[model samples]
Structures are given as C-alpha cells and as structure tokens.
Target: MTDWIASPLEWLQNYQLNLLFSAVVVVVYFIIRRIVLPKLEAYVERDNLNQQTFRSALFTFSLLSAVVALGILLLIWGINIRELLAVSTGIMALTGVALFATWSILSNVTAFFILLSHQSYRRGNYIRVIDVDNYIEGYISEINMFNTILITEDRETVVYPNNLLTARATIINPRDRKRPIGKIEDFRKTETSVDGGLNDKD
Candidate 1:
C-alpha cells in the first residue's frame, strides 16, 4: 500500500498548486451563480422567467463544474493530459445524447423566443395558421416558451407548436383584437365573388 502511494509521490507532491487551483475554481463558480446570474435574471425577467438566460447560466455553471472536477481528478489520480482529454470526450458524447433527446422541446422553445422577438402577435391578438389540411384561426390566449395557446372563435383553446405558427401564414384581426381573423383573404374573396354574382343577377 505504501509502495503504491510512493510510486507517484514525486509527481504529485505539489499539493499547494492543486489547492490554489481548486480554491480559485470554487470561488469563480460561486460568484457566477450567486452574483452574476441573479443580476442577469433581474434584468431579463419581468413577469415571465427568462428561459434563455436561465439556460445560459446553467450551461456556464455546468462547464465550470466539469472543468474544476476534471482538474481535481487529474491532480488526485496523477493522470496525464491524454486521459483528461479522453474523459472530456466522453462528457461531450453524453451532452450530445442529451441534446438529441430533448431536441423537439428545445426547438419549440427556441421558436417561441423567435416569435416574441419579431413582435408579431401578443396575447388577445387574433391569428390563424395552416394545420394539417386547414388553417386554425383563433385569438392568442397565452404565449410561452413551449406552445402557443390559441382560443378559437368556437371558444376552444388549441395548442400548437411554436415553429408551426411562426412558419406559416397567420392573419390577425386588426378590428377586434379579441378574436383572430383566421384566413383573411379567403373571406374577402368569397364576399367579393358573392357581391359580383348578385350584381349580375340584378
């Protein structure tokens, strides 16, 4: 047991360097999480939580924790840089798996943010989008990071993926902000055709 300990004793003798590095890393981690993140959150968050800011903070914290852990592991195990690289590669692989698993959720969330940035529609704005074979027109009930909740003229709330709403044509009612003017041009065309037919008959 003593022999095993002494075998790498010469290379691992610098306890002071390891301790200093660890201390700095821990200090940085706390400062970012407790100080910086909260300040950022205060600015970004009004009534709704800022998912993008929160995710950014989470990623930063995760990266810092992983780096600190890796460094400490190297110092304790006396492993060289090559082993550290291998471990980091494995961590990246796991991250890739996580991203793939939650891709749809992430996509919808991202699309929601994009729509908000455009200032296209807000709650109570009437709008319509093509879904499957027909376009669903309704008033915007709530816009969140995941799905857009729409209340149709029939007084039904329908949920749609944010991506679909942002991608397709949505007609908003400029008159009555309470209800969406789903398929605006279609209604106008129909009315015009009917009026022309009546005029011809007269």
Candidate 2:
C-alpha cells in the first residue's frame, strides 16, 4: 500500500515536465467546458433554437473537444499522430464508399444546421412553400434532422425533406402582435358542418 502511494509520487517527481503539460491540458478542457459551452448555450437559448438542434450542436462541439484532447494526450505520451490520422483517413474513405447513401442523409443534416443559422422559420410558425406545381402552406409542427413536418389547414400532415426546404422559397408568418387570420374555432366549425352534411345525406 505504501509502495503504491510512493510510486506515483516518485513518478510525478521524475516526470515534472509531462505532469505540467497534462495539468495544462486538463485546465484548458475545463475552461472550454465552463466558459465556451455556456456562451454557446446562451446564444442558442437567445435564438429560441429547438431542443433537437441545440442538442446536436452541443454534441458536435463536445465530440470535437474530446477529439482534440485525445490528440494532445497522445502527443504528450509520445505517440505519432500523423500515421494514426493517415490510417483513419483511409478507413473513412473506404467507409464513405460503402455508405454512399450517407451523402443524401448528410445533405439533410447539413441543411438542418443551415436552418438553425438562417432562423427564417421555427416550429409553430406558419409558412408557405412557393411551388407552382406542389404548393404547401401549413404550421410547422416539428423540425427533425432530416425532415420538417407541417400540419395543414385541412388537418393533413406533410413531411418535407430538409434539403428540399433549403432549396425552396418559403414565406414565414412570425408570431407578431397581430390577430390570426384563421382561428382553431373556425376549423372546428368547418369540420362540424361537414359532419352534419354527411349525417343529413345518410
């Protein structure tokens, strides 16, 4: 038990320079987590970003930070990062070729980030996609990694690909201090009238 405790102390004394470098790395990681992450989270909250988008961004940032920290630790331990990166790149290239369908998925993911940055529309906002052949107007119900769901006036749900949405022109109706053109009561009344007409015919 004493040997184990003394061994670590002796190693630390012998490797003072390495220990100092490691301490610096740990301090930097904590500073980034404490200072940088909170600032990013504050910005996301200020923009009223969706939970999914915020989580994705946060996860990406954390993953990048972990990778950087691992690289620094590897260098501190005298590992050759260049050879490791080269091997990783080769493996990634092969994986990319095998998962060619991933390109489409990646495009949708990329568009999701673009949507967050653009902030043109959000869930619960009314929007109209300007398409001559396939026009769509509805309230955004959800924004996912690959699709945006909209609920129409007719109670129909439409799923639009994120990539397609990014390419199209969209008109957004923000929640300003103005009366809504159509209320939920109006839709309810219309539905009741339709049901009544069907009953009368029966």
Candidate 3:
C-alpha cells in the first residue's frame, strides 16, 4: 500500500509541471462551464427548432467539449502531453466516424421532434409517406424519437424512420392545418360588429 502511494507521490514531485497544468485545466473548465455553455444554451433555446434538438445538440456538444477539456486537463496534470495529443487526435477521428455512422439515427431523432413541433401531422391525421417508392397512407398514432407509429385502415401499425418522414413527400389534411395568430388589443373601442358583437378583427 505504501509503495503504491509512494510511487504516485514521487511522480507528482518529479513532474510538478503536471500538477500545475492540472490546476490550470480545472480553472479553464469552470470558466467554460460558467460562461460559454450558458451562452450557447441561451442561443439554442431562442432559435426556432424543436426544443429537443436544441437541447440535445447543446448537451452533446457540451459533453464532448467537456470531455476534450478533461483530456487536456489530464495532460496538464501529469500525463505526457505528447501521448495526450495523440489520444485526442484519435478520439477526434473516432468522433467523426461515429457521427457519420449514426447519421440516420440522429437525423430521425431530430426530424421526429421537428415533425411534432410543426404540427405537420398530428394524432389521427391522415398522412401518406412513400416507402420503397410506394405511397403508404395511414393515420399517425404516435410520434416518438427515431420511429413514427402509423396505423392503417386495416389496423396494421407501420413504424417508419423520422428521417424518411422528413425526406419524402407528405400529405396532411388541409382542415388539420393550424397557424399561429398573435393577439392585438385595440387601444379604444371604436366600432361594433354587424351582429352587435365586439369588433376585435382588424
């Protein structure tokens, strides 16, 4: 037990620079946590996207950035900077590959919330999404991440990827379309309606 502690302690003493580097890393990480991340999150929240997408991307980026920062911290603390650099490069390469590998899954997840937010179609709304170059008409039963649950007239449930949902042409009932209209308050009550009702329509 003494040998274990002694070895690490001796290493720290010999490489005091490593310990100093670690301290600097900790300070930088907290700075980013306090400053950068919050600003990015605010920007993401204000943008017009599915809340989930904004939240997810912000979270993922924060996690990735923190991890990278930690690695840099490790190099500063005691690990060889050369080795850390190599490891970081390798990690970046792997990240690029992973993002591409999971493109469809990510895209589907993003589009799912987008579909729901836009009210492009809602539960019980009839929709047609072409699959395999064939149009499948069905009613949306449930919409979730990755897959959308659709039920046909025959009561068969078809699960389709949201990526496909965004890509393919979709038809929604015109009656189901609802757009937002902001309220305007009249400063003074000037005119009454033809039927003796309040004329709020400007």
> Number of the top candidate by lDDT?
2
Q: Cα miss at 36, model 2 (Å)?
A: 4.8
Instruction: Provide the lDDT at 22 for model 2.
Output: 81
Give the per-residue lDDT of model 1 (tens digit) for 107-181.
Answer: 555565555545456556677576443567777776665678888777887988776777676666644433333
- List the candidate 3 regions with Cα displacement exceeding 4 Å: 1-103, 131-133, 174-202
lDDT per residue for candidate 3 within 1-202, as digits (tens), equals: 9999999899888988867877777787788778865654454344333455546645655676688787777666567878777888898786666443435466665565456556556667777664443566677776665677778777778887777787777767534322121122232233334334534443
Q: What Cα-based lDDT does every candidate model obtain?
A: 0.63, 0.70, 0.63
lDDT by residue (1-202, candidate 2, tens digit) is 9999999999888888877898899899988988867765654565565667677767866876787787677778767678867876886676455323334666676576566556566667788775443446788777666788878867788888887787877778734322222332555788999999999999
Per-residue lDDT of 184 in model 2: 28
Model 2 Cα displacement at 188 (Å)? 38
For model 1, the superposed segments whose C-alpha errors exceed 4 Å read: 1-13, 43-45, 48-80, 93-202
Order candidates by lDDT, high to low.
Answer: 2, 3, 1
TM-scores for candidates 1 onward, in order = 0.43, 0.55, 0.41
Instruction: Output the better candidate (2/3) by TM-score.
Output: 2
| Candidate 1 least-lDDT 10 residues | 175-184
